[model samples]
Target: MSHTPTRLRVVRAAAALTAGAALFVGGPAGVALAAPPAVVAAATDHSLHLEGAPNARDVGGYETVDGKTVRTNTVFRTDALDKLTPADLAKLEGWNVKVVDDLRTVYERALQPDKLPAGATSNWYDVLGQAPITTALDLQSAYVAFIDAPGASEAFASVLRDIRETDGTVLYHCSAGKDRTGWTTAVLLTILGVDRATVNADYMLTNEYVDDSGSSISGSLMGGGVKQEWLDTSFATAEAKYGSFDNYVHQGLGLTDNDIAALKAKLLV
Candidate 1:
C-alpha cells in the first residue's frame, strides 16, 4: 500500500539524530536515526510515486520554521531511468523535470546510461563512492560512514546552488539513490533546520524503496542493493567527519553565508 505516518513518526520520537552517529561502524556508542517525517510525507502527499521507479519522489511542500514550504516538483531522487515504461515516462514528462542531474560516476553511467525524460537537461556529477574519505574506508560498511561524509553534502549543495541560478525541475540520483541521494536530501532539509531524527528517517526510507533482496525499482529508477553496507556507513562518515548534518551542508558543501541566505529565500516562505 502507501507509506504511513507511523513509519515517519518513529524518526521524531526515538531516533536521536546525533547520539548514534558516533557509532558509524554499528555499535552501542552512537544513535539510531530514522527518515525525516517530512520527506516521507512528501513522497505521499504529492502522489509522485511511479509504478517502476521505487524511490522516485519530489521534495516539495515541506514546512519551514517560518511557516514556508519547499516548492513542489522541483527535486526528485531515484536510480537509473534507462528502463522506464511508456506510462511511467509520461508521468515524469507531466512533472516537467527539466534538469536531470546524473550523480553516477563515469563508470556507472557507462554501464547504464539514463534514458532521460524527453527535453530534460541531463547533467553529470560524480559522488565519489570508490574514493574513501578516510584511510580505513570500507564500502557498504555501516550507516556511520554514510552519515559522516562531507563529499556527499558538497555534491548535494551544488544541486541546490544550480536551482537558484537556473529554472526547471531537477531530478538527481546515483546508482541507487541510497547512499548519495539519501545524504544529499538529508543535508538539504537539515539546512532548513528541519530536525535530526527526521533526517535519519528520510535516510532509512531506502528500505521501503527496495525489496526483499534489497535492490528495488520505481518506474525506471532503482534503489537498495544486496548487502549494501555503504548506506549506513556513508551517513556515519558524514556525522563523524562533519559534526552535524547542518555543518556538512554548510561547510562541506562550501555554501557561503550569502548562498545559504539565498537558499533560504528561494526555499523558505
Candidate 2:
C-alpha cells in the first residue's frame, strides 16, 4: 500500500502553520507544573483490535540493556483514532489512557478528528511542521526534511516530556503509524537502551499490523513496507547532525539528561 498522497507539496507547505495550535509544553514554566510520577501496570491487551484503528499496539515489554524492561500499557502507538469502534473505546478506557498525542497536521486532523476515549485529552503535535508536510507522498524527501527540520527535535522532546509527566498511557500517532509515529518510537526505544536490532524489529511490525490492502505503491520505494532504509536514514540523519542518537535526544531535542532519567523512571522497570 502506497502511503504517499500525490498532491502539490507547496500547497500543503503553505497550510502547515495554520492547521492547529501547537501543544508543546513551554520550557522552564512547564517544569514546575509537571505531574507527579505514576507507576504503570501490565496491559490487558498488548495488541488492540479496532475497526477504525488497525495499527494500535502497546510499546512495552522490551528489555533494556541493564535487564530492566519497558513498563507495559504505559505507551501506545496507533495509526489514527478517527475510526474507533465502541468496543475499541471501551478497551482504551479500561487502560485508562490519559494523553492522546495526535502527530498529524491540522488538515489531517480536520479530515478525521480523533474519537478519543472519554476524558483522554488530545494534543496536536504536528510532526511535519518543519518539513514540506505531505501525507504519504515523497516519503524519502519528507523523511530527510523531518530529520533536518529544527522543529523535529522540539516535537520529539515535547512528547518525551509529556510521557514523563503524564500519569497514564500516552498514545501517539501519525496518519499511517509508520513514519512520524515510527520515528518517535525509535527515539524512545533508543533512549531506553534497546538494541538497534530490537528497535528495527519493533518498527517493522507496522507492516505486519497495518493492512495496506488495495493501496497503490506507485512512487513508493518499499511498496509501503516499512523499509529498512527508512530506519537507517533516521539514525544516519541523527548521526550526521548530532554525532549519535543519544546526543540527538539530549542536544538536538533540548532534553536534559535529567529529563531522560525522569522518562526512564516513569516508563521503565
Candidate 3:
C-alpha cells in the first residue's frame, strides 16, 4: 500500500481541523499540547523533559562504529525555545548549555524569538532562507535543500564547527525540531560514525516528542511528522552531487578531516 495517499489524507484532515477551529478565532491554531509527563519520563534515556520545549533531547549514548559512545549532556537538539518557562531555563542552566543555535528564518524568529537559558548565547542560521518559503510544502525538496540550497551548506557547516569549538553543550533547534534540526543531527551523527539504521531511528523519534497540530498551516503541514523517505532524500542528494556522504561532509559542507577528528574527540568517550 502506498503511504503517500495516507500521509496526504492525514495532512488534509489536520488542515481541515485547524481551519475549522480557526473560524471561531481570528487566526490559525497555536495550541500545541506537550507529550504526557509519563511518556516524557519514559524517554528520559535520551529525552529532556522541558516544560516549554518538550521536544528537547540529547543526541548521545549511541555507540559509534569504532565502539566509542557519544557523550550525553554534551549536545542537544530541541524545538523552538520561545515558550521556555523559568523552570525550564533553570534546567538548561544545570545542563550547561553554552550555545543555542536557531535554525529558523528571520520571520519565524521575529514572531517568537528563542528564550534562552541564562548565560547561553544564540546563533541565527536561516537554513532555508535561500529557497522560497513555499519549498517547505514539498518535503523532498526541502530535505534536499538542507544540503544543496545556497547558504544552507554554510549554515550547516557553521553549526558543526560551533559544536566542535564551543565550550559546554551546544543546542540547536528549528521550529518543530524535526526537519532542519533533524537533518543537522543526522549529518552530525553520520559524520561521527553512527550507522544508518540508528541515525534513522533517532530522526523518527520526533513524532514521539512534538504535537505540531497547533502550529501555523504551513508548519503543521510540513512538520506534521517525519518520514524516512524524506530523510533519505538528503543522503541521496549528497550521493548524487558529491559521490558519497563522506564527500558531502568534506566537500559539500566544507569540513576537513582534522575538523571531523576534533568533533569526534569532543563528542565521543
Q: Look at candidate 1 and tell me the lDDT of residue 97.
A: 66
Model 1 TM-score relative to the real fold: 0.69
- Candidate that beats the other on lDDT, 2 or 3, i.e. the better one: 3
The residue-by-residue lDDT of candidate 1 on 89-173, one tens digit each, is: 7777776667887766555675567877777888776555433434123334323533433344455666777655445567877
Ranking, TM-score, top scorer first: 3, 2, 1
Could you arrange the candidates by lDDT from highest to lowest?
A: 3, 2, 1
Question: Candidate 3's residue-wise lDDT over 57-114, tens digit each?
Answer: 7887677777767767778899878889998888888878899998877666765688
Instruction: Kindly report which residue stretches of model 3 are placed more than 4 angstroms away from their true locations once superposed.
Output: 1-44, 215-222
Q: In terms of TM-score, which candidate is stronger, 1 or 3?
A: 3
TM-score for each of the candidates: 0.69, 0.79, 0.81
TM-score of 2: 0.79
Candidate 1 weakest ten by summed lDDT: 10-19
Per-model lDDT: 0.54, 0.67, 0.72
The clash count for each model shown is: 48, 5, 0
Give the top-scoring candidate (TM-score): 3
Q: After superposition, how far is residue 163 of candidate 1 from its true place, in Å?
A: 2.4
